[model samples]
Target: MDTVVQERLSTKIQKAVRKTMKYIVDEHDVRARRFLPRNDLESILNKKRLEQLFRELLSNEYASDTATAIPTGSDTGSAEGHDSSIEIDSAVDTCVKATIGTGNVSRRALLALFLYQPHTRLLSLYVEWLTSGHPRIRKPSYDDHEIPCDKSIPFTEGDLETLNIPFTNHGYIMDYQTIFTPMTIRKFTHHDFKTRDRLPFLGAKEKIKDGSSGTVYKTNIAPGHWEFKTSDGRFLPENPDTSMVVALKIFKTIEGPWGTRDAKEVETDFNIERELLDSLRKRNISHRMIMLHWGSFSVRDADGIPSYHALIFELATFSLEAFLKDEECYRIFTDKSPVLAGLVDIVEALHCLHEHLGFFHLDIKPENILVFVEPESVHSGSNHEEGRKLIWKLSDFGLAREKGSTRERTGHRLSSSYYSSQPSTLPATRPAGLYQAPEIQSSSSSQAGPGSDVWSMGCVILMVLASIIEGPEGVTDLSSKLEVFFLNAAGKQKLFYVRNDSHSW
Candidate 1:
């Protein structure tokens, strides 16, 4: 396990135990008309005992033979040939025996065991077990035992000024207010922007894009529900009623012929992206050409384990590739000048990244160039046009590195076999060979720098120009003509590049 993950899990467990114990003591006070001393409760419900009990329940519930773990209220069906109720009862019985012992257990201990349903994820099973008339303790009302959401922490004015984040009604800064603490993602649906496929089933995540490092999804955050206090202690969005849609990028474990990339490497990638974004935020560099990173949070699995670390970002209407391919959008860009201007905006953004920040966005391509179309313009016909307003921004910095970093370019490529196994409809996981600089294509090269990024940008420009002049089909034809293929040492037909026979562009 990654150290970060271990720390988060330990913290969550400790918090859960404390909350359960608190609930038990509160219930005891209500019943006996007298408060129990902290030491008395400690004798029955120490952190270690409750922590072990919760862990045992988690292990039993998530066992391979058991029903699905962490029943998120959606999966009510049981596993085939498995009686989950029986398993739950047995696990609960063993936990009660081991933690409380067979002797006369105190009412506080019974309440403590009963109140653990929410923490251990046993939910109704724990309630049902308690109802079997073991000494007839009165069942607590649902409202009495349910855990409340964490209260939003107000940001001191000094804190905001120190971080250089401004107080503004601008959508980007407003969205930033919702992310100071990691907000829990309750439900989200994924949409694949490239294929534009509607999900077959409802309530499923619409996967916008999948890459070698992570997957991105579109999700909504309720403004007031996730609102933050300002420097003066008032919530930024006084209204806080509306919902804002944002992009959720979740980092995943990468497996290839090289070997399986572990959680630590994935965590490192997550941290690098966060640090880069934070640097941009602290400098108050909210450029229109750069995607706004709201914040980052972790997603827990059924067993309450932090399965994936995710970042929140401003969601764009489309990618550059998707925009050019859509017939309606192509018609909107008929003037060609605006298309060229958008490309220039991207260039300026790259300049900010490379020159201002001293960072290299090694993985620059069409798919990473996000296009934000005004909502009003999306439905407008070509005849009604003041022309569609488009904002292009650079995104997906998983392969980015600082100017002089010594880290190897492990993310540059995947095994040929791994690449081949991906779905045909999905966009290329990384920059296609046609867009890669010669240095990136050469396995012998040690590193790619700013010039390499410029080379990639030039390739993007050619594709954009081709789309404006010849449309999507013309871009396809240009790609086929420029593409040169070769086999790697593994006898796999893997390499793709645009250089001529003499190795010169």
Candidate 2:
């Protein structure tokens, strides 16, 4: 008897739910077609009308009709029980789910109904019910409403990561209402670098090198003659009055080996370089290091996405590698003293890096060591002083690691001269005979540390000194000399002796 009554009640409830939804579709659903926001459509439907519709559908007359249509306690067989279940299923199918699945009602329109009346728990419950795959709720098609897109800023998922905000993934469009602002959206546009009001001049630039990560440009930051220091321990302005040439390293705004262009990577590079520079600023040892002005900034590309980071550095005359390759530059080698002096300054920078900053310059090579040209004293200085006067400083900390940090292999191609023998989890990629420490070569599990840097530095110094002593032959035979030192028994003894003697010196 109770089963019969419950079936009759369920049938009536399904009918009421269908009628209520149809009325809502007819009235509120009309405004949705005009592309009004979900809130406005709900306001048009109003709370009073929604409650009134439910009230009308559950009236006493409907209950009386439901009770009269099904006789209770009159049938008692398996066939009768099966027939009642079929009737209830049919009612739910034809009546309860008739509106949502088989109609032209947009998913946006239906979703909007739930999103309205924000403080209510109904929205969350409605979403749960809709997704539950209940027999009475049909799966609705969501293709009717086109997502509104901002054509001006066509940023991708990667580009949007630059904002550093949390967002929900909804296909191509993001749904982060609480986090996004008008200012944030404007940042996604490419209008920042065009102004001469704040940013430094990037025009009339000579392109230096365009690499996978960033582009480097040679630009004049100011106009004047410049020197790293004056004789009296005061720092000189970088030729602020006349042709202050500097190197501008601009990070790639788009297209870097797929994931390399992500904002996190860009931010990591920015923070690491900025913080490292910040920690090193104004120290007495900074004189021996690459001079990076606090002028670090960011810029958006044409697509309104932050594409690159801009940092201003004191321009190196050329790399030490370039200095060696020059035939004319080698004329100043009166002995090994010039190479030794430059090596001392580079070692000092490394000392500061290791002892003071707790950092290890993982990538150390002749190319990473920049040679700063000092202006001649206008009185035609002697070759001896000038030869030993070449200032060498460390640059390119892109692969640098703090001391005690685990070694992770980088994507950069290693020069044979610069490769360090550290056990890297990354495969031995592009291996050729070169200058890695014995520990690195013998075991793939050995980690890189300060000693690894010392080894690389020694190799660089050896090559430079060898080139000077052996004249043209050392530069040409650099590859063979490196191989002999790392591979030959006699060369190893000579290397050990040099290492011991260097500590005494």
Candidate 3:
């Protein structure tokens, strides 16, 4: 190869190696921070050793290049050959000295090099050094040693070995399921409620509301005796009979041939909701905005196929729709301050879902906005509504989709009843709700995106603002005036919206 061309190729290869090293270092840094003590992790990624290793690697590369380039046979003993070898060695030494002297190689770069080439003999030496009882490398365990022995530190090497974790050829555990199971199990065991076989015993559920997709029921849970830390960093004992209520949402199941196909579809939707909620839980998103998912369970039919799917969530006081209809609660919204504050809260929740989590809650409506009243106010029957705290949370994510995902069509209502009547040409029927965006109304339009969710939220905010400004009577009057009647395929009058010249609602 031409000298210049070879040099260019080598430079590109070096750049690629450095980039890969950086990525590997970043990935391991994140994982190590979660499971390993900071001091121990820093020791494991020793900077001095990394710099030495990098210098040796560079020297070896240059030495190999010189060996391949030098003349073979009797010419190897010539003065010309000896001079060429000395010059190559001199250049390689200069480059190595410059790399170390300039402090160009960082600890991360060194760690990356080791991680990127784990099969290299150097990595085995590094591992041996790590296990040689270095003072900085403390034994893997939780920071606090005063805790009970039964409360084992999670994800330790011992624990991983006990679980018989499978490791890759590179000596790294790649089985995320086995690694995360311990944490998941710990979370469930330490949760506020106890369960039997991973299924919480929700006693005698009362139907709260009926929807096309499923029904929600309010039920009490058998509370566990787990102690939890409060916001101010104080541990508090949980009351076993403090009336811990939860919401149980059961997905609707069908029967027969068509129903059998529909059952699978229902299961798919149930899994989507569960997975989304689980994602939120794993990310530790604010429970004040997004409802906390406790657990999920399914019932199988005689053929051993799943028939009924249910999810357990933290119960809210009431839906925003129901709250507005209540004479007492409606009065609270009459004050513009509370209404504006509530709107901000809901908007922040939507922002978290859309921007932070990259999820679009396609079904945003007043009914899906759950309201949680302060427990003290609820029990004390406080007449001072202004002092009461109302937490607004976004719920009912059965129709939610991840941003940029187009594998499945959006806006399909979870109800089995609507499936038979759905038009074949359209991707899916728009959910039966007044808050649907304009793009969703047209059959030929593309799948609903993040903007669709914003539109629905805007509609909800509009209704909420109108209720606060004009009271319940004003909202009712406004709805009556905007109601447009149109004939459907069955020649029945259906309430719809007609766009004006400017395309405004």
Could you say which candidate leads in lDDT?
1
Candidate order by lDDT, decreasing, is: 1, 3, 2
RMSDs, each prediction? Answer: 21.1, 24.0, 22.0
Q: Give the TM-score comparing model 3 with the true structure, all chains together.
A: 0.51
- 1 versus 3: better lDDT goes to: 1
Pairwise lDDT winner, candidates 2 and 3: 3
lDDT score of residue 269 within candidate 3: 68
The digit string of per-residue lDDT tens for model 3 on 1-505 reads 1133223323433343232222234565333212211122234334454344434443344354454554555665476567644654444343233223333222232233334323344333333222233232222332222211112322356554543334442244332211211111112222221111122232345799865456898864433322345679754434343435668798766443223326667777677777767777777555468765666766664355765677777788889887765667776644567557877998998888867776777788889999887744343344566566778889888777664444342226322111213212223355335787665654454345667678888888777877776667766766676654443432322123564322334
Best by TM-score: 1
Runs of candidate 3 exceeding 4 Å displacement: 1-203, 223-239, 255-261, 284-287, 301-303, 332-334, 375-383, 406-428, 487-496, 499-505
TM-score (C-alpha) between model 2 and the true structure = 0.46
Stretch of 10 with least lDDT, candidate 1: 193-202
Specify the poorest-scoring 10-residue window by lDDT in model 3.
177-186
Q: Please give, for residues 1-505, the per-residue lDDT of candidate 2 as tens digits.
A: 1123223333433332232223234443322111222223333334443333223332222243343344455565455546645544443333223212343332323323223213123332233233234343233322212211122122356644542223442222332221111111011112244211122232356776653345778864322213344569654444444445577777653564434456656655655655556656645555556544435666654565565676667678788877787766776645557567888888888887867765666667777788876764552456544533577888776656554443332333221212234423222222222344433432233344567677877878777776777755676676544322333333432221223222433
Score residue 412 of candidate 3 by CA lDDT: 60
Q: List the residue pairs that clash in candidate 1.
A: 157-231, 189-205, 189-206, 190-205, 190-206, 190-207, 191-206
Please give the CA lDDT of all the candidate structures: 0.52, 0.46, 0.51
TM, every model? 0.53, 0.46, 0.51
